[model samples]
Target: MEIIPSNGEIFLGKEQSFICKSSVEATMKWLSGDDDEEIEDELGRYKKELIDETTLTLQVTASKVEPDRIIKCQAETESGETTNTEIKIRIIQKPTFVKDVSVTKVFNADSDAKLPCAVEGIPTPQVTWFRNDMPVPLLPGHLSATRDGTLTISKIQLSDAGMYYCQAYIRERNEIEHKNVTVTVNAAPMVTFEEPFPKITSKSNASFTCSVTGHPKPEIVWKKGEEVVSDDGQKYILSSNGLQLSITDLAKDDEGNYTCYASNSLGQQSTTLTLEVIDAPRGVGAGVVAGIILLIILGTLLAVDLTCYRTRRRGFLMFLSTSILGRPAPRVKLEDDLKKGTSDKSHVVNISGIDA
Candidate 1:
């Protein structure tokens, strides 16, 4: 007796048939597995048919058939002797997933990201990462796929945010299994103000604009010192797009630091702008007017004294002179002593026009 197929190879979830033929007419029977389980007609997913007196056929369809098993075809002759021919049957399972099929992952920009696609098959499935329906190129540590069905993207960028597929492929069977993965990358806001320190005169109008960049569109906010600034519509006004702030009638109190804050789902950033207000000229005070008047009075007295000394020899300064004893002014005349040969001089006292 001989089996039509020397060895049986069947794919999972598919039917395989084996034929047994004998040289002469004989009774045929089929058994399977190591325990020699008897094969009967129409047993579950297994079927047996007698094609002819010398030929027998067995059909088998099982969900799981792992390792390798033997299917034996037995033939009995009229001499009461039995002969058997066995064939090794192997089941090839198609690629299937053992991990979550629907996956969504979020990663911050410039950080590493991992996408998993765990699978199983008869011949260990090969994993590959795809984007936009194209296979992703291997980029050493930057972008690569591991043997354990993991896809790694190092230093992920903002452009890397998109839909990706982790696919498991069974090349021999041409079977594919893939999982859809949505990747999201978040970037922190970066805020910058062109004019960090701006100057404007007091009682004038001034404006400041901020330039911001980030993912998901950052929200703009303004603050002065530690307090949040609200638009009063008249004194403080914000642009319609909220990127600029205008102050009307700027005062010395509004000359502090103003901060432009930008925030998003990922992170926040802020920049400070110093507002310097120059005060306008003002009127003189009471103290300054009094000092000017005092300077004018002293200047007039000095001019009068100088004019009198040059014009009148006995002016106001000479009238205030007196003797040490508090007497009226005295007059004296100098006389040469030439009449005396010894060059000696004598003084004569005259009080109230009387010589003494």
Candidate 2:
């Protein structure tokens, strides 16, 4: 008798079979190593099948097989003599994770970070590391791996933050296992303004915006000089998220250097905003003042003309009244002078006539 396969190797959770062939017809039985008693056939796990009168097959299911176990097939003839052959079985198991990787890990900027992945399997599985789905090259100072499948990073930076994967591979089983971890690097607050403070006229609206980035989500504050700014609702309004500062009815006082401060647990940073406030153009202001002065001059001229006309009227009326009341005495004196000598004697008679 002879066994079809002399030796066999199979991975765990798989099936293997050994066949025995004899030249003459015989009763076939399956047995275990060095046992006088015949091996009983189990329904699905272990079974003995007769291919023909000269051939017999022994099938071992995945659950029934063990590493380094021997399976024997025996053929007994009608005369009660038995011939047997044996085959050795080797089992391989795929790698499996002992502990799951952490979903996320945080590290401060310029600090060190460690990531671990533990696995268990036969023949010692090999572990590899990857970042953002790309293979990580071995760098002496920056990145390295420990003997226990742990990845270490020195002087972590913002660029080093991303998805990291640990893969355990077993060549014998032709299987691979993966675990994912996300690394986050916390950095100091970085502040930036979209635009410089703009030039605005009085009673106009204006806004200042600042963009900030940090690991812990830094807080933003607006300040002018030494005083902190608050939302006044009517004139000064802060945005819902407090990233922008809005001003309505801008005035000359608002024109100055403004500061935007961003702070977090890591550190703080600030930026300056230069605001310029300009008045109306010189030509327009000069024109308005000149027009007011011209109107005042014209009004003064008109008042002077009305006063002179009233004065002239009053003087003419006084002269007319004096002429009418005192004219007869002067004419009478001139006529009397011419006839003074002759009228001396007649004066007495004329006085009497005048009385009459």
Candidate 3:
């Protein structure tokens, strides 16, 4: 007996077949290893078929194939002699992922971090790493990979924050699988000012803002000397996020050294600003004083005019009273004129004499 396709390899879950033939009619049997008992034929997995009176075929699935397993086809004639041929079966399987990589990882600056990916299958898969769709090298310093397919990073910085991927490649099956993870690096607060030292006019509105950068969103605070600034009343207005200080109707007292403090869980930072308030010009002040003095002089002149008019009117009244009643003329004989019933055109009489 002769077997067709003496050796074969197939992937798991696939079907493989071998044919055996003899010139004369004979009973066909299939055996595995050196077992005396014949191998039983199953319906789908393992099957035995007769092609004519002399040819036999054995069909087996990759799931039934074992390591170093050999199948023998034997033909026994009525004379009690046997002829046999053997076929070797090899099983191959595709790569499969056992553990998926982490979806996301977070680390502070100057810290260490790791990403993991694991896989299992026949013809062991090889693992590779990538960052932001670019291949990552297995280097000695900064970034490296461990034997178990773990990507390690030392002293992580802000620039290292990005998307990372792990890939598993199987050469025999020509298959590749991938897992992705996102890494974030947190940093401390950094404070800066647009205008480091600002010069503003007195009695005008002024606003100072401190720009901040950090992760976890730093909290902002404004300080002057030992006192912390807040929105206590209308004089000072603090921004909602506390990054700005607004002064309405600014005065000379508002001018000073101001400090902005930005802090978070990681660390804190500060920036100082010197505010110079320039007073109004001397010429403008002098004009204002001259205007006030002119108003006072005009008011004094109005008062004096009113007083003089009142004094003149009082003197005129006194003179008219004295002319009418204070002067006494000689007494005329009013009584004699009345007795004579004579008409006297002009006669003067004293009031005391004419009482009767």
- State which candidate has the highest lDDT: 1
Residue-pair clashes per candidate: 0, 0, 1
Candidate 2 lDDT (Cα, whole model)? 0.76
Candidate 3 yields a Cα-based lDDT of: 0.77
Question: Which residue runs of candidate 1 sit more than 4 Å off their true CA positions?
Answer: 1-7, 13-24, 31-55, 61-65, 70-88, 109-111, 155-157, 192-217, 221-260, 271-356
Score every model by TM-score.
Answer: 0.51, 0.56, 0.53
Per-candidate Cα lDDT values, in order, are 0.80, 0.76, 0.77
Which candidate number would show the highest TM-score if scored against the true structure? Answer: 2
Give a tens-digit lDDT track for model 1, residues 34-149: 87778776654578899998999988775675677888998888888888899988888777888785777989888999888878888888888899999998999799888887
Candidate 3 on 1-356: residue-level lDDT in tens? Answer: 68887766667778888888887898888888667568888765688888876898888887743575777888899899888888777776666566656577899988888887777656678888998678886667789898778888988887788898888888866888888889988999989999988999888898899999887789888898768988876988898899889888878888888999999899999999999999866565788888998788556545544443454444433333234322352232222223356564332222342222
Backbone steric clashes in candidate 1, count: 0
Which ten contiguous residues of candidate 1 have the minimum total lDDT? 320-329
Candidates arranged by TM-score, highest first? 2, 3, 1
| Residue-level lDDT tens digits of model 2 in 1-356 | 88877766655677778788898899887777756466778865677788998898877766643557676777889999888777776676677777878589999988989888888766678999988677888799999999789898999888888899999898866789898899999999888887776777777788889988787888888898778989999878999878899988887888888888999999999998888877755455788898998788556545543443454444533443234224242211101223555644211101111111
Worst 10 residues of 2 by lDDT: 347-356
